[model samples]
Structure formats: C-alpha cells, structure tokens
Target: MNMNESFQTLNFLPRGKFKVELVPGVSKTNFLSICYGALTTIGLLTFISYSTNYVLLENLAYERSQIGTIVGNLQVIAEIVLLSIFLPIGLIADKIGRRQVYSFGMLTMGLAYFLYPLATGIAELTVYRVIYAIGMGTATGMLGTVTADYPQNHTRGKMIAVTGILNATGVIIVSLFFARLPKTFADMGFDQITAGKYSMWIVAATCVITAVVVALGLQKGTPTEEQKKIPYLKQIKAGLAEGRKPRIQLVYASAFVARADLVIIGTFLVLWGTMAGKDMGMTTAEAQSAARIVFVTSSMSALVASPIIGYLIDKVDRIKAVSFCMAIAAAGYLSMFFINDVLSPDVKPLFVLLGVGHQCAFFAATTLLGQEAPKMKRGAIVGVFNLAGAAGILISTGIGGKIYDVIGPYAPFVLIGFCNIAVSLFAIYVSKTSPDVKEA
Candidate 1:
C-alpha cells in the first residue's frame, strides 16, 4: 500500500481557530498519534517527578534533611547520562525512524519504573535512574524533533500550542490522579511500602501500553528524505554550524532556561510542598497529595493559556515571542520569593502565574526552533537544542539541590528566575540586532 494513501487529513480542531497545515506526507493520523504520545509521555514523566520523593521517603527511608541533596544528585546523574547520549540519539533518529526510537524509549522508561520501587538503597536507585535517563533523553529528544517535523512553517505555533495543551493535560491528569495513587492505595489498607510499589507498577504498565500505541500509530520511516545523499558526519556538522546564527543561539539559550524552569517546578515545587506538609505533621502520602495540588494548579493554568500563547506566537516574530515568554517566566519564578507557604490556598494565584510563564517559555522556544531549523537536519539540530536543555538541567538541579538544603526551597526558584530574565534580555537584543529571516 502507498504510505500517503493510507494516512488521513487532520480534523481534530476547527479550521478557523487552528489553521493547521501539515507538512507533505503527514496525515491527521500521524498528528493525532503524536498528540496522544505527547499526552502519555509527559504524563508519565511528571508522575515520576512527583512520585520520586515518595519512593525516597516511604520505600528507601531516606532522611528528609538529605532528600534535597539526593534528588538533586540523582537529577545531575541523569543529566550527565542524557548529555552523553542526546546528540547521538538525534543523529540516530535521523538515520532510523522516529517511531522505532520513540517506542524503545517508552519501553526503557517502563523498565526503569519497574525497577524503581524495588530499590533497597540509593545506589541501586541511581543505576535505575541511568536507565531512565537514557529513555527520557531519547523520547523527549524525538518529541521535540517530530513536533518540528510535522507542521508547516506558517502553522507551527498552533501545532506547538496543540501539543503544549496536551502536555499540560497529561501533567494535570497525572498530578491529580496518578500522583495520588500511593495515597489512594494506602487508604485501601495497604502499608506505605506496598502502596508505593503498587502505584509505580501501575504506571509501569501504562508505559508499556503507551509504547505499543506509539510503535503502531505513529508514521513510520526516516523523516529525512536526503538521508542517503547526505554523509552522516556532514549532517552532524551542519546541525552544529547553524548555531552560528544569533537567532539559533537565542533558541539554544531559551532551551537552557526553559528546561530548567520545567525541572525546578517538577523536582522542587513538589518537594517543597511535600516537605512543608511533613513539617505540618502530615503523612508522606498525604504530603505528596498536598504538593500535587499546587503542582496541578500550575499545569491547569498552563492548559488554559496554551491556545492564546500559540496564536500569539504565530502572529509575531518568534524571537519577540520568546522575549515576552521569558519576561513572564521571570515574573513567575521570582514571585516564589514572596510566598511563605507553598501549600496555602492564598498562594494558588501565584502558582497560576507560574504555570502561564512556564507554558509561554516552552512554547516560544519550541516554536522558534521549529521555524528556524532546516528540514533536512531538523533531527540533529533539535538534538543540539535538547543538549542545551540537558546542560541547564545539570547545572540548575546540581546547584538548586544544594541550596534547597542550605538556604530554602525558594532559592532554586529565585536562581532560575534570574536566568529567565537574562534570556529575556538577550532575546530583546537579538530581536533588534538579528531578527529572524522571514520564511519564504
């Protein structure tokens, strides 16, 4: 059967609002499958972020005073693993099909989850995390690459917006329901350790299921048409050389802070709230549930703002859009300094602001990359973009964790807040000096 004949047009949204224009050979089926993949993959990742603290506290019996450092170290280790593999994975994705790489990543994550709860010590858990890092780096790298691959330049923002909405939806569902699974199981008469294990296993099963869905539903074969013509080494060099452009440099910068913004929220926000809950005499599971409420508040706000941000990105110069996003991110992260209690209802509005900021930064960076990256080298370029992100995670988490223990939970938020402001300033300068070349 002809591949193009087998695929269908995208009809997921109204033509008037979305104005989607898929690249040649991409079908509605491919787009929708990508959307579903976005929903599950991010949901699974968020669940892991929220649930890790529980594993440490409930299963491993790690000291609360030390958790900040431990989680930080674990993330640093993961980032190290990711840093080594991200570029190669991108190069490989260009060589193979996105579906095969993506499916393998999901399966690897499943294996990590299955091993996570079984860890009797931090050492064993670190080994499992290295596995998780490889999977995470691959899946997330493709998510960015494929997102860039599927949409036409004119409609790229809207496409990104759609996926962003799905990403937030995944985070919300996982945060609201799946994050509470350990607590839910405990309420069902299971002990803390047993409850934690069962909850993780359930997530593991979902990872396996998601792997199957991605393998079957996504468009198959290498996205690069010139794969055979271009020498492999030249492809890598071409991807790197694009960084000579000031705008791509800005994209790389945006990616750095953008990823840090995400990790800070995912790793620290919940940890902050959970520790606060414990201080208030709550159980580990109860503390985690309380933390998720705040986390969900941010995700919910991001969900509501997605379409608006997407439309805005498509209408303006993407570099300008990035500046606007970073300004918002700066505001949101800096606001943490004023909040004394993360678990307080009064603080929900601040979280709402934070969520919007996060969504904007992510959307801006991705849409800009999608717009600027050459089609033939998209995978490798996106890989380098993700490498910037991995570096951000390594530095931010590595230091954020230590200060989280020494100074306060708010310290990490403040640190990244300043970084966002720096990028926003850089974007503003780039817009004036080296505006994006208008797409032909």
Candidate 2:
C-alpha cells in the first residue's frame, strides 16, 4: 500500500484526532502479534531502562565515581554475557521458532529482577546483572527479528516507530510510577534497601506477566520453503558473508553506536544528574526525582519523535536518513558540554534533541537491516546485528565509565558526540558510493 493509504487505514481516529494507526495489510493475527510485541517491549525496556538505571543502580555505590565505574562494569559484563549467547540463541530461534526463545528470555529477566534487590554488594549485583543479560541476549535478538517479520517492507519504519513509542511509554510509566516508588517507601519510613527491593519486585512481577502474554499471544511463522531447505550452517555462513558488503558494514557500525546511545544516557545521565542534585544540597530522594525528570524528558521527546522519524525513514534514503539523525544526536550530545548543572533548564532542549536523534538512528538502522537481510536468514543476521550492539555497549560503557570518573562527567558524552559526527560522515560516504540502495 501507498504511504497515504497506509496512514489512513491504519487507524480509526475521529476526524483529526491524533492516534496510532496500524500498518497496511495487517491481519487480526498480525495485529495481535504487534500488540503483544508492544506490550512485551514495554515491560522489558521499562525494567532495563527505567527501573534499573533510574532507581536500582544509583544506590548500589555511594561515591559518584565509584558508581560510574560500577555501572560501567555492569554493562561490560552484561554485554559479554549477551554476546556469548546471542548467536546461538538466534540459531536456535531460526531452527525452532522465535516465540519460545522470546518468551523464555522474559522468564529469565523476571528471575533476575527478583534477585536484584537481594544483592548485598557489587559482586552479587554483578551476578544478577549477568542473569539479566542472558535474558536480554535471547529476548532482544528475537524482538528485532520478529518485529521485522511482521511489517511490510514499505511500512517497516512505521512499525518500528510504534514499538519505539511503546518503549518510550514504558520508560515514562516506570519513571513516573516505579522510579519514584522507592522514594515513596522511604518517605513512609522504610530503610533504603527495603524500599528499593520492593520497587524491584514490582518490576519482576511485570516481567512474569509479560512472559505469559508473549508465550500465549505471539505466533510462530512457517519458514519459507527455501528457508526450510537450507542447512543451519549455510545460513550462518551466508549471514556472515553479507557483512562484507558496505551497507551491512554500515549497519554494524550503526549498531555499535546506536546500542550504546541509550545505555550511556540511561546509566550515566542519571548518575551525573543525581550527583549534581546532591551537590546542590538535595536529599537522595530529591536527587532521584531530578534524575527521573531528565529520564522522562528524554523519553517523552523520543515518544514524540518516533512517528515523525518513522515517516521520514519511509520517504528518504535510509543511509541519508540515518546520517541526518546522527548529526542531530551529535549536536544534542555536544550541547550538553555547556551545561554546568544537570538540572538546568538548558538541558531539556539537549534531551529532546538527543531523544529525537537517537530514536531516528535506531529505527533507520533497524529498517535498513530488515531491507538488506534476506528473510530466510534474518534471524541469523539480526543475531550478528545484536552482537555488534552488545560490543558497542561493552566498549563504550567500559571506557565511558572510566571516562566519567577520570576525565569529567561530560567526558563520555563528548567522546560519543565525536563518534556520532564521524559516523555521520561515514554514512554520507556510503550513500555516495553505494548503488541499488533500495536492496539495502
């Protein structure tokens, strides 16, 4: 279907009301799958981004620099765990079905979250983080591949944007309700550890609920007859062979940068903002609130930007579109350099800019991968896609954590900003040299 028709028929909005529309040719089955995917995305991302970043990690280490290092280490370890299992899980999903792998990951996550509050120190926390990473490894790989499975090529970006919206909404919901729940418990005279654990248990419950929904609601697709004929090893070899192409190379590059964007922001941004608030004489509760505001502002901005960016992805060249988004992200991260206080009004614009920029890059990259990778081998390709992302998280956060402590609070952002600019230029070069762009 055409873009205009896709928009008009996707939803049943009254007159000019703003509401999300379904993509064209969406069956009741496809619609249910999308809805369940959104719901699952909401639960998982909320736990990963909001509950953990905004709430749990902050209290783990008292020293600001120590917290930075610890958070960085957590990411490093988790990504390593994710990297180890991602390819195998992808292969398994392709061999059997995505639904089982996807739902099983959620179950792993729920178990990990339940253990999070039980940790007595950094070492125990690291163990829990690894468990969570295992879940993340399996679930995230499937989520991307399955999402690509559902959308028509023309509407892939829009479908991704809808999930992005759900992700943002998840962040907002957890930020508003769960991020503050610990503080609420503290206000009621609970001890710090108790208050935090209670909040985490709530997230754990959500994970369980989401897992059940996914296991029941998500459907398995019949592999194409051609796909059925290929050996698993041949599929793996083909997926790796595609990596030598310039477009696939670019997508890998995008994965490295894009995966770390939110992680750095979610983990360190909270660390900086909360520490800054404490420096300004705010209590722990107040500081956390300030950090939540930062998280919420960025999420809300991304929420607003997702659909618009999705539309742009449909109309523009994916390479050029990603380059533009990277440019915006670079500008946003660079602007943060000038803000002396994390809570300053000056930071909101930067948050919005970063949000829009990052989300755009995210969808553009996903859409490109969806377009470029053959359907039969998509799960394997997406496995590699996530491996690159995991590596990005590992390298950037590992160095960024140290950078946060050694160079300055703004150092990590500065480093990533430069990387974004460099990548943006690389994308332009690819656009100039690459032909048959639509195939990618």
Candidate 3:
C-alpha cells in the first residue's frame, strides 16, 4: 500500500479521522533528528551496555571490580522496576497518547544517564542505575510498537534490524566513548568517573532534542478521552488472542527461550571470563573484552540478518525456521565450555559462530512476533513479547549473577544453552503436532 493508504486504513483510529497529510517526510527536523536520535539511542545503550565494561574492568574480571556484590541486585531491582511498570506504562500510553509518553522516554533515559558519575558506593550507584534503566525500559518498550504502527511487513524485518543495529551502535558508542574517558579526565585534571559523567550529559541533551523533533515530524490522530480509556488488559488480551495464529505461538515459545540465553550472556559472560582468568592467566581487561566482543559481534549481525530472517518467515513454515535458528544458538552457548579447555589463550574468534547463531535465532524469533501481530493491536503484542524477553533478562541477570558467584562462572551459559536447546526441541515437537503453524 502507498503511504497515504497506509495512513488512511490504519484501523486503530476512527475511519474518517485518519487522514494522510501531504507534508515533507524529512524536514529541517530530520537533520536535527539524525543527530539527536543517535545520541538518545547511545545514552540508553550506555547504562545497559556499561555493565559489560564494569564486568570486564572491575568486579567480574578483576578482584578490584568491587561492584559485583551489588551489581546483579541493582540490575534485577531496576528491571523489576522497569517491568513492573510495563503493562501499566502501556496502559498509560493508550490513555495519555504515545508520542508524549514516548518522547518522555527519550528524555527520561537521557536524564537518567546523568547519574552514572555519582557513585560513592555500591548502594548509591545501584539506586541511580535503576532509575537510568527505567528510562531505557520506556524506549525499549515503545520503539518497535511505534515503528510497526502502520504495518509494512516486507521491510518490517529491516526496520527491526535497524533498531537492533542502532541499539548495538549505541553500545559501540559507549564502549568507544568510555574507552577514551580516562585520558580525557586526566587531561582535564579530573578523575575517570568524573569525565564519564559528561557522557550522560551529552546523552541527555540529545534526548531533549529528539523529543522535540518527534513532536514535530510525525502526525498521529488525537484520541477522544473515551477512546483513550479503552480498558487496558481487556484490549491487550484481545490483541493477544487476535495475534495467536498458528505461527505466533511457536514464535513466542522459541523467542522467549532463545532470549533467555541473551539474558544469561549479558549478565555473566564478563564475570565468567574474569573468573576463568585467575587460572587461565589473563588480565581483567582481556576477560571483559572477551565478553564485550561477543555482544558487539552478535548485535552487529542483526542489522543484516533480521530482514532476511523476516522474509524467510513469511515464505516458509515459521515454526521450523525459528526452531532451527534457536537450535544453532544453543550450540553456540554450549561450545563456550570448550573455549577455556581448548583455546586457553583467548576465545574471541569462537564467537563469530556464536554471533551468527544468536543473530539468526533472535531475529527469526522477533520476526515471527511481527508477522503474527495484528495491525490494530501491535502495541499489546509487542509489549507482551518484550515482557517475555524482559522476564528472561530478569531471571538471567538476577539468578545468573548469584550462580556466577556461587556455582562457578560457567554455570549460567551451560544452563542457558541446555535450556534453549531443550526448548527448541520442544517447540519443534509442538510445531509438528500442530499442522497449521503458519502466520496470517
């Protein structure tokens, strides 16, 4: 459909009210947005991605990394804080309208970044981190929902991949930016952490600008208070039901479990690398770098893989496709145990395989969610999918952290790989049992 037709037929709005305004798609605002959106994306990523830095540079990798005792707890608490408000924030979006609240998320995450340098102790850092994470949570929850608002699936996978690329690019930004901070702080006669504080300032400034740009660029139909007040759970439940074609269920099961592996790696990889280094003979920086490499590579691949995966889903049996991708991811995680035993000196190259597997699985799973979701209720289905993914992060970061401390560092990935593979097998079994497993 043409852009005008897409706007007019958007069933989420009143039939007569959805108008296609003939306006410049890229205004003076797009020029500003290019910069601001990158910044906002960066700021949100720093808090989420910096944990890897902390893992490599400090507690997990080095004995000096004192934040470990509290880091996992802080992450868990903050994610809870984020997730606790998810369904409600979604309700709030429907009630107050998406642009205003989503813009606030951009602003919220930027503002949240400002607190990173204030860490006097673990307690203070954790509290501040929780606040920062909540802001990112809002962006995380809303971005895809907003993007797919009009439902153009042919390129939808590409858009989703772009989101992941932007997100990973943000990680690279923080990584590169922080990599230079110690030198910058030294030049300015300040401490490293003090200089790092300015990163958030940059992030926050960008968010404010993006919020304004979004306010100007796109037009959404205004909802009457009556339309806005549509009962939250009822609509969400209906959307879930509407979206549950033969394909969506398989996607959810595969995606949720596959995502759990990510949750584990994000939380424990650096810590595990660091722990192994004591005997394996490596430095803290090297260990953390090991983990960071895994994340960067895995995330970067999504930009290329996501859209292709999306196209594949539309053409093939989505259940089998997603199942195969997840099985590969499981093997990636399982292969890690061999790294220390075999590679011993360093194990970064092994991650190329891991990255490929993870990208395929993650994008395939997410692509399926997009395929199965109804045009009218994309928000609710996306919310639930993210919620399930978030649940995986919660379990992995919280419980995984504890396990890393107590059970031996390899414990988390081993568990994640086993669970992922087992689940993929279960999904495949389920797919075979349900003959009609295809998207609407």
**Deviation (Å) of 82 in candidate 2:** 1.3
Model 1 CA RMSD to the hidden true structure, in angstroms: 2.5
Q: State in Å the error of residue 26, model 1.
A: 0.9
lDDT to native, each model: 0.88, 0.75, 0.56
In candidate 1, what are the lDDT values of residues 1-440, reduced to their tens digit?
12234343343455455666777778767877899899988878877676579889988888989999999999999999999988889888888889889989999998998899999888999999999998888888888888888887888898899899999999998898888988999999999888888888888888898888878877788875677477779988998999989988998999999988888999999999999999999999899999999999999999999999999999988898899999999999999999998888998999999999999999999998998888787887888999999999999999999999999999999999999999999999999999647451
Model 3, runs deviating above 4 Å? 1-43, 49-69, 187-189, 206-210, 222-229, 239-248, 258-263, 270-295, 301-311, 341-346, 435-440
Model 2 residue 284 CA deviation in Å? 3.3
**1 against 2, candidate with superior TM-score:** 1
**Over the stretch 1-440, how does candidate 3's per-residue lDDT look in tens digits?**
12343232222134522221222232233323332453445434544444434422442233433334345676677767766766666656656665666677777766665655545556666676777766766765555455444335544454445444555566555444543443455467754344445644665666677677655653353223454656777767865685455456665565566566555655555455444543466543344444444455544554455445545555566567777778878887777766654224365555655655666667677666766776445566666666666676677667666765666556667667776787678667867776563232
lDDT by residue for model 2 (1-83), tens: 22244332343234523333433344455556656656555435544544444344445645654767767887899989988
Per-candidate TM-scores read: 0.96, 0.91, 0.76
Q: Please give the lDDT score at residue 137 for candidate 2.
A: 79
Work out candidate 3's RMSD over C-alphas: 6.7
What order do candidates take by TM-score, descending? 1, 2, 3
